[model samples]
Target chain A: MKRTFPLIIAAVAGYVMVVAYFMPALQQVREDAEEWFNILAAIAMILGGASILGMHLRKVSDRRAGWGFSVVTLLGFLVTLYVGLFKVGVPPMPEYPDRAWTGEYIAQGSALWWSFEYIIYPITATMFALLAFYVASAAFRAFRAKNLEAMLLLGTAFVILLGRSYAGTLLTGWYAEEYPNLTLPGLTDMIMGVFNTAGQRAVMIGIALGIAATSLKILLGIDRSYLGSRNG
Target chain B: MKTETIILNSFLGLGVIALALWMIAWGQEGKFLGAQYVEVRDTIEVYDSRELAWFRTPDPDDPEETIGYWVERAALPDSEPPELADPEAGDVVVEPADLDRFTPARTWEIQRGVSRDRADEDGVVLSLSRTIGLWFAAICTLFVFSFLYRDNPFYKFAEALVVGVSAAYSMVVAYWTMVIPNLIGKLLPDLVQAAFVPEHDQPFYAPHIGVLILSILLLWRLSPVGGWVARWPLAFIIGTTAGFRLIAHLESDFAIQIQATILPLVVRDDGGFNFWMSVRHLVIMLGVMAGLTYFFFSIEHKGFVGKTARVGIWVLMITFGAGFAYTVMGRITLLTNRIEYLFDDWLWLIS
Candidate 1:
């Protein structure tokens, strides 16, 4: 019953959505479905929070490696949730001067606001900044010219590294002045705008066709693997 | 650690400390070892002579009462107030003072945003609080950046704090912005209306009923013996996404991409092939065919097909390498921004 019911739902939902896209009268159905999605998505976000907390709690309870970090995570999560939901440090809005706790949770000077501006923004920025260092190290480890393909990769990497920076400009600036086409930047741009775009386009076309076929399969109940084996 | 590694680490540490000290010195008097942004006065290319840069001119949308309106640095240093400043014959020399300019005219040496009143420095309310806040921010920023050296307690704490706070902030924003306003407020229209907030008149639509039933069905999965009930919601979600993605991808990723590849080999603007453009066009055409061929597993890659695939591999590598470099450049930009914030905003080191 579970298998058959979901398949029926899948077919109905899939066909309804496809039809909604094509037919003019059923346009509102798409919008309504999106609204339905939003409500479900909000609940899903809450579910995510629950899942993260649950995982961390279990880890802490188990006394696993990095369990102390898990404790920190839980403490951080709880404190933030408390401050945000309770509007701990929020002052009343100017319009409603006399009203207590009737202010935006993110009002300036509030604890949550302070935490966001000071604690959250900086850490996030720094975390993301690690990617620059990580990528550089990754390139060093990965780029070994062992074969013709590897050599080509390395050559391209060198062109890109130089061309995108002041070093490339310095090296090829004279050539650029005499012949714009011969310049490294010019070569890089041409390579990217033309060759890259073409390759990307081909890949995307293949992916799109694959998605359409998969969608068809699911709609026809030919891909019941998502639910489980039919025997189960 | 090896001596060489220790030496490098020491130098990095020294550089950071030196930079910090220089910032403190600059903040005190706006001159740290005579270092400043070499004021480059030049005209930048203008698109639409009337259009304004961000925070440059008064916003047309907002009323005059809004702050940051009258401030602009469009006028050249030598020129008298440029009314219809010709973009072709104008130079801008913007400095820190320019941004803090509150007056309609310069020669008014008054710093606008900055409170120059010496007495206010001692004022416990705004000054003390702001000072504490800036220090707190700087300390947190340092804690996060400590991860660059090695993961420690400070870094872990900072990471946890950021993750937790951001997650909560997002949830709070969603609840207030979406769920409460759309669902609860709409459903309890009269009560919400009485609370001086707008609510939809027609909330009990077919979609609403459908969503409720489905939501109930979804929640039913949470029950001990009813886990299978969740399959319906999962299937619905997957089906809808598949349908949506199919059409969206087909239109955008396939049709548009295919259409885009149909390009002219000649550079028409310069009235000829322009020498290298023809070569570029040829390379692109070949690359596309070869790349598609490489992905085509139906034919066994041998002889002619294998050669084409090899060329395609080169194209793919070039594409990936260029993409990686671009991403690296972007990440470096963000890192540069944080460094700038540390100096200019946090430490008050440089202008």
Candidate 2:
């Protein structure tokens, strides 16, 4: 019964969502279901937080390798959670000066806002920036004109890289007035708009068909993998 | 560490110290990196009443000719009065005193002359917290970038902090933006409106009770006992998402793409027989068809199919190359921005 109940719930929910597209009256049902899903998702985040805390706590308690890092993680998590949940340094709304909880959780000058601006933004941006060097090094090592396909790929990449930068304009500015289509930027635009779009569309269509078929299988109970192991 | 590594580290440290010293000297010469905020007192003119007197005028819809009558509000006392003209005869005379006879056309609260008076230098000082925040950000950025050289304690510390903080940040954001506003606000409208959202007037949705119950069940997953019950909510989520995506993808990706691919082989314009446009359309149609043919694995790839599929492979390669180039460009732009932040905002080395 443990697995059967969840399977029934899945089938019913899936069928209802599919059928709602045809019947306008069932639109409210679909919206309500979506709302329920959102609430569950939010609750799932809390579960995720708990899981992280539990895992870190276990590692710290066990005195595992890099336990100091785990301590740092716990401190960061708890401090951020405390400040955000309690709305520390967050002023009350202008209309509700007497109500402290009425203020925005991430209002300017709040501790949470400070953490986000100073810590989160810089770290994430720098992490992404570091990828630039890696991508360049990877391209240098991987790109080779061994075959017709490789040559085409390499040539297209070269054109795109140049066209996106100021150097392309400097190189092809003279030809732009006479033979615009032969210029780097013009070729780049053509490649992106025509060939790239065609390839993307074909891939997307295949993915759509695959998704539809899988969804149908789930709805009909032909696929019950989402319910997890039968032993449960 | 190797002797070479120690030497390199020493040189890097000395370079950073030198840059800092130069920045300090530059700041002493009247250029600084911190933000300066100003205080200003605003002067506003509030109207006594929302009611405004209006008059009938010729419609200004067409520039060359007046077609119909249009009702306009009375001009402010300081502004020029609008000229009332007859639509057909082109002229109508109305006395200034007669303007008051027109009925009030609109009710709107208007505030005018909202000017600001800037305060003195005392109000233009830098924020200590903001300066400190900038320094912290700069340090964190350096720490993250340190991973490029080699994994170190500083990078690990920054990584851990980011992971923990971001996870909690998302949770906090979701709680305030989604759960509290949508679920709690709906379930207990009066209480939420009184304490939180002053404008919230959502009627209690009975279905939200189900949502609350499901949320509780989902949260039960964190507990040691009866964690298996969370499967119900998880299954619902998976099922609903699958169903929604199925229709959405089919309509937007499959049907629409196929529809768009049905292009005219011959194109014409106002000048007639646009050759370039015709070639572009032909290429798009043939490209899409060939690309789709490559994905069709049911038929053996030989003869005509093989040639078309080969063309498809070339198209796909170009697509991937272009995509990679765009991604690299984006990442390089981000790197450039970070460098600018360091040199301009942190060190004050650049304008």
The candidate that wins on DockQ is 2
List, residue by residue over A25-144, the lDDT tens digit for candidate 2: 999999888887887888889988998899999999999999999999999999999999888877655444334477778876678998998899989999999999999999899888
Off by over 4 Å in 2: B26-122
Chain B vs. true chain B: TM-score per candidate: 0.60, 0.74
Which candidate leads in TM-score?
2
DockQ metric for all predictions: 0.33, 0.39
lDDT of 1 at A148: 79
Tens-digit lDDT string for candidate 1 (B182-288): 66555665654334233235453444766666766766655668667767777777778777877888899888877777767775555645756666676777888
Instruction: List the lowest-lDDT window of 10 residues for candidate 2 chain B.
Output: B110-119
Per-residue lDDT of B123-225 in model 2, one digit per residue for the tens? 3434456668888888889999989988999999999999899989989988888888899999899988878776688989877888788788888777788
DockQ for candidate 2: 0.39
Candidate 2 Cα deviation (angstroms), residue B272:
1.3
Provide the TM-score for each candidate, comma-separated. 0.73, 0.84
Model 1 residue-pair collision total: 1
Which structure among the candidates has the greatest lDDT?
2
Error of 1 at B173 (Å): 3.1
